[model samples]
Target chain A: MPSVKENTIVTTAAAVELRGLRKSYGEVVALANLDLSIEPGELIALLGPSGCGKTTALRTLAGFETTDEGKVLVDGDDITRLPANKRDMGMVFQAYSLFPNMTVLDNVSFGLRIRKANSAERTRRATELLELVGLPEHAARFPHQLSGGQQQRIALARALAIQPRVLLLDEPLSALDALVRVQLRDEIRRVQTELGITTLFVTHDQSEALSIADRVGVMYQGKLEQLAAPAELYSRPATAFVAEFVGTMNRLPGLMNGGTVTVAGRSLPVDGTAPASGSEVDVLVRPEAITLRPAEDGGGLIIATTFLGSVTRVRARLADGIEVSADLPSHQASALTAGTHVTLELDEQPVLVAAPLPR
Target chain B: MAQPVTARLGRGAAWAAFAAYFLVPMGASIYFTLFDRDNHFSATPYTGLFQASGFVPALQMSVEMGVLTVVVLLALLLPAMVTIQLSMPRLRPIVETLCTMPLVIPPIAFVAGIIALQTRLSDADPYGPLSQLVNNQLMQTGLPLLLVFSYVVLALPFAYRALDAGLRLLPLRTLVDAARGLGASWPTVLLRVIMPNLRTAILNAAILTLALVLGEFTLATLLGFTPFPVWIVTSGGDHAQQSTAASIVSLLVTWGGLLILSVFGDRRRTA
Candidate 1:
């Protein structure tokens, strides 16, 4: 029932590598000796905070920023010296980047028009991209007439219409409504996968990176903290920054020994590289790994409970005056009240531990 | 919320004041142009403009200079503005200070500086070919072409303001990057994307340049050339009635031209 062109790939797979990129603005370093490689047809999301250099890395790859010392290689071609227009890449920008004067159809066909594609061919490819993004009916409309989500969809179509070797997305969904953002992010992933294009998506939103990217690269202070699969990055962070930034981590005071950290009378195996033996450390635990139970002699008291659809997060204060939050099934947490005393237990998952910080 | 009756009356009075200030002199001029000394209707003031010597040529020269000045303004300011916004944003404050500098300088002082430069260049022989090129090629072009370059400076504040406001409305760097990533060369991006998107700004700036050039008199008169305004004053010393008609016609034509340009920019952009 599908068309003949649906199964064929339009964009060729490209291996993108950024090696030793070093950029600075006066005294501030935006990127410092940064290196990243994306395999053919893979989606890599660079995740970080506002000044973390993730967007700078993406812009460097797109040839927008001239690195003080680095090489940008696409399919083994050193393109660090190449101009952006000659790089033959596609970039979906963060803002409403559609040309205001051009119609949606014209915007999509812009690349084709620049390449001197004839009318019929340009229209065919543009129409194909529009249909791919599911907006064939809005081609005649201007960008201002479409909703923010729709305009971004057209932007995506325009990026892909040229069959670019690698696609660069610079926080393309940060301005949209929450519901629309999720929807558009899913569509972007779907279309990128369907075309088998190598993509680098940059964002400060950890959830967005975790949900769509094949591998997430966490950046901090102009340096790469860690790069790994979403589950691995979440479950076994290489650095304490990555561990704390990706998701909520409850740091409980615990003692570290070779392969384990003991917290609340229980010793759990360390998830990542274990710290020195017999050292004072702060053990990291996810909210979901904590189990709760009612006990007459319990040293913990439930302070608050927040419902999050199928699950609930319960905040409790320990005998040591440390607060810990546990994610429990909403059905079971409904029975617990603020005045109740509860005992906490850890699921057998390996825990990450960091050095104790000065109070 | 509805305004109170007293507040409404106050607003109405303010509007009446502005309307009276704008329309009263215009009404008097219209009455003067349409009547003769005998208190009967006549079109001589309007018709006599055609009979004036060098009227058409002076008007033609002003239009030409206006168009050329606008062309130069766009060619000079747009690239500088885009480059500042996209590449070297740190230079923005400095560039803005430089561009809006004409506003602080009086026209008389600016024209005096130009006259000094012209006098110096006219007698230059030690600089060799450069001086020869300036003295022979440029100085010989008469007033129409020489005035364009000076008018561009005087018109910079207005034109730059228009273009800067328009560029502010756009995510200029993003649009340029998007275009370049799509395989558009620099000229293609400028002509196709940035320029088309800037139609309203271009039109607005062009109109401002035209208005300035068509109404400017000091520089043209001091330079010993008779552009439209200079010709209007020189010829008006003898023909009092037609001078009033000429001033009114210039105002009306500038308004009409600006309206047409606004409509053209808006309609074409939306269409």
Candidate 2:
């Protein structure tokens, strides 16, 4: 049986840094003074909406785009002005970037051939990459003959064949369906971890970013709002945008006081910076942090229930005409049905609070 | 169940009609070429092509013009089209308009404009550099380069449609970026990556240009040149049987060549 290469070349990874990156197209700025630094062998996911400059940052680092003012450094060497062909980066696009005219083997070995590797060496390396990607018998098939997922795997193998300086993924999984997307993402993560290559993954899917990245950078309006560990980013967002964008956050009216906020007669410390005291704020609470129980005299009435595999979501309306949603274990939520009166209990986790909207 | 009998009959009728429309003229041409003056079967008209005056030279001239037109057209249009689609996308409509302008104006009008310009230039300065360049070098060459230029324009609508369809089937920007990121230079990317994928489309363009160049009569004749079509028409005055036979032979040759090429292209693609 063909197997993964016994000796995959292990090269030392480089630290990548982007400083004061600025880009604008006529009136609209695509990237502001954005700056980022990545440690060697680390994978950072840039997460944002479309046109939020995540892709622009990745492209600029790949030397595909010229920034108005910026410096791209790899291991402290400035490479901002290098052409894409000279950057030695490997990229997997959204999908369908495979050269349709080439067989899978030819596609994989193309980079090595460009570097003037000998024939046997190219074939052996290409075969190893194909084996690494778990499609050992597919070397002779053209790209169009493969399934979409298979095509992407071959594309991944092609990218890694050269052991490129850095790996850049530009929404590579967005073209796939949900099941294939998750599977390929896990495959990508495993391969990236095994290779110990520095990577920049740009995606609009928050779950994809949160599940696979060492750190996730949230961007908005051409700015990096925050870059933090996935857990920290989800639990304690630096901005309201980050809080709402990363995960589902239920907004409840609260009164801010010093470093704490009061919501529905209960008090909790703020997750990040709190607004000035004695002002109304929007308290962002995670669904998992809220507990619900049936009580006739409770202040909230159960309005609906939704089954989500092991977790069930319960929506309730308070006496003051505010609605809240909570996610709880399915066993615990069996009794929480529509028209049941429930008393809500908040966990001890600090809650993020956003400034109140203008009246 | 198999296809319905009525549906089969409808398909049969469609094929019969198509065959009749396509084969009637072919059969008639064969009949005309095979019969001699004594009403006996002979291959003289077909074999007599080699002996016919102006036949070989006109054929050679047309073939040369067709080959040059395909080369120059592809060289100019491929990079230009790719650039317009990739970086200068905002200029797409302008380029498309310029490429397809020949389709709007009559070929006669286009040739008239060319001839008028040459006339005006030659009249203004009989021995000037501009007149000499236009008259002697460009038009009066051993085989006129002007016909090749005109054929490229005449074939534009067809070549553009072919190439555009092929390009639409591709994720052009993504492929280019991926190839560049893999360390292929721009020329390497174009030749090895993009052009190879465009093989069938390019052949389609080349065939269209060849057909246009070989069959074009108005531009060559109006500009005072006698290419294949003009020779064919002029030969009809003295040698009508040979002229008709040559038409049939040329049609068969073109179709046979295209069939071979398509088969060859398909084998390469599958391999």
Candidate 3:
């Protein structure tokens, strides 16, 4: 096994900085003055829906696309005008971009060959990378002979073979099946940590980003809406878009008075920026934060119940015609079937509140 | 379980149609070539091929032309197609249309156009550089360079489709970018990476070009070039037996070559 500390000592990975990156196609903007800085040896995941500029940002950093306005710096060296071949960045695409004609070892050693490394050194390094990716025995196999997950692993090994200062992965696990996706996701994180390479991973799956990234950057409409650690991003979203995009958020009509918002006849202190007093706002609540109990005089009706292994989700319709879902322990939710009356209460945790939508 | 009566009849009819389409003509050709006037099978016609005048030279000329056509066609088309696909994808439809235009033009009309162009160029002022270049000894040789050019045009559609299909199966842009990112130059990427992956397509294109060159008659005949097909036709008027025998041999050779190519193409190594 390659020691993470030893690898880190051998090569100090470079920090990546993107300053005011802006790109557009005719009238439509893809990236709008996005600025971000990633630390050395840190893994940052840019998460967004399709066409949200996450891919555009990653490609710009990879030097595949020229930003209309921006400066890309690696270790404080300006690489904005550099061509892709000279940038020294390794990329693993969503599709299995392994050269189909070459065997696994050849694919991994392609960069070394391009760099004019002799045969013995290239083979040694390629063998080491294959072993790192847990496919040492598959060196002689062609790409088509491997399964999808195995092919992707080989692609990853090939990308890392170049010792790129910064690694870019564009939805590498999106093509994999669910079980293999999760398994490969953990495998990628393990390899990344073991190498201590600065990586920028672009993906649309929220759980994938949250589970793998040191910091998750939620993007919306060509802008970074919120960039925070996974736990902070999930619990305390900085914007309404981030709150809704990251996880299941139930929007409840509330009135903001002073620093508190009133929802479901209960007052709760707001966490982030709140609207002025006496303004209507939408209070964002997570399902697990809402507690439910069976009551004869309940204000909500349990309209549906779904068993989700460890937790059962119950959808309840309030008297005001607003429906909300609450997750409960499977054993406790056994009695809360559809058509049962249930009273709802909010926990005392600080909640995020957004300004009311335009009428 | 036994097959239904109607199903068996349908299968039998299909087999009969296949046999009629393929075996009958082949058997007749063989019969004509092998049997002498006494109606007894003999190999005299096959032996007569060696004694026929101009047979060996014409056959050699056609083989050389076929090989040259394949080389020139690949050299011209592959780079042009790769460049177009990489940088100028908007021009793909126009290029494809232009490549298939030869199929629309009859062979006679195409040869007439080439003859007219050659005449116009040859009749130009002798002192002019273009005229001097065209009137050179190399151009005056009876090597039928014009036939090779025409064969390349005729083979374009097949070559294009084979290469286009192969390129479509690959993520060309991504592959190029990946190679470039790994510090490989454009030439390196094309030769080492892209060309290896396109082995089957290249083989198919080359075989198609070779077949087109070998069997083409109108252009060669009208141009007064005695290539293999022209030789075969001219010999048919005098030595019918040798001509039929040569045709059968050529047909089998082409089919055998294609079969071998396909086998090589399919024999991809497993882990």
Best by DockQ: 1
Tell me candidate 1's fraction of native contacts, as a decimal between 0 and 1. 0.92
Per-residue lDDT for A148-224 in model 1, tens only?
99999999989988889999999999999999999999998888877789999999999999999999999998888
- Candidate 2: residue B193 Cα off by (Å): 1.4
Error of 2 at B233 (Å): 1.4
Write down the lDDT of every candidate, Cα atoms only: 0.88, 0.89, 0.88
Residue-level lDDT of model 2, residues A289-357, one tens digit each, is 899889999989999999998999999998878788999999999999999999988887788898765
C-alpha RMSD of each candidate structure in angstroms: 2.3, 2.3, 2.9
Question: Which segments of candidate 2 are over 4 A away from where they belong?
Answer: A1-5, A357-359, B2-6, B119-134
> Clashing pairs in model 2?
none
Error of 3 at A68 (Å): 2.5
Q: Compose the digit string of candidate 2's lDDT tens values, residues B84-155.
A: 888999998888888888899998889988888777666647567767766665675348887788888899
Give me candidate 2's interface root-mean-square deviation. 1.0
Candidate 2 docking quality: incorrect, acceptable, medium or high: medium
Candidate 1 yields a Cα-based lDDT of 0.88
TM-score against native, each model = 0.94, 0.95, 0.92
- Model 2 Cα shift for residue A257 (angstroms): 2.2
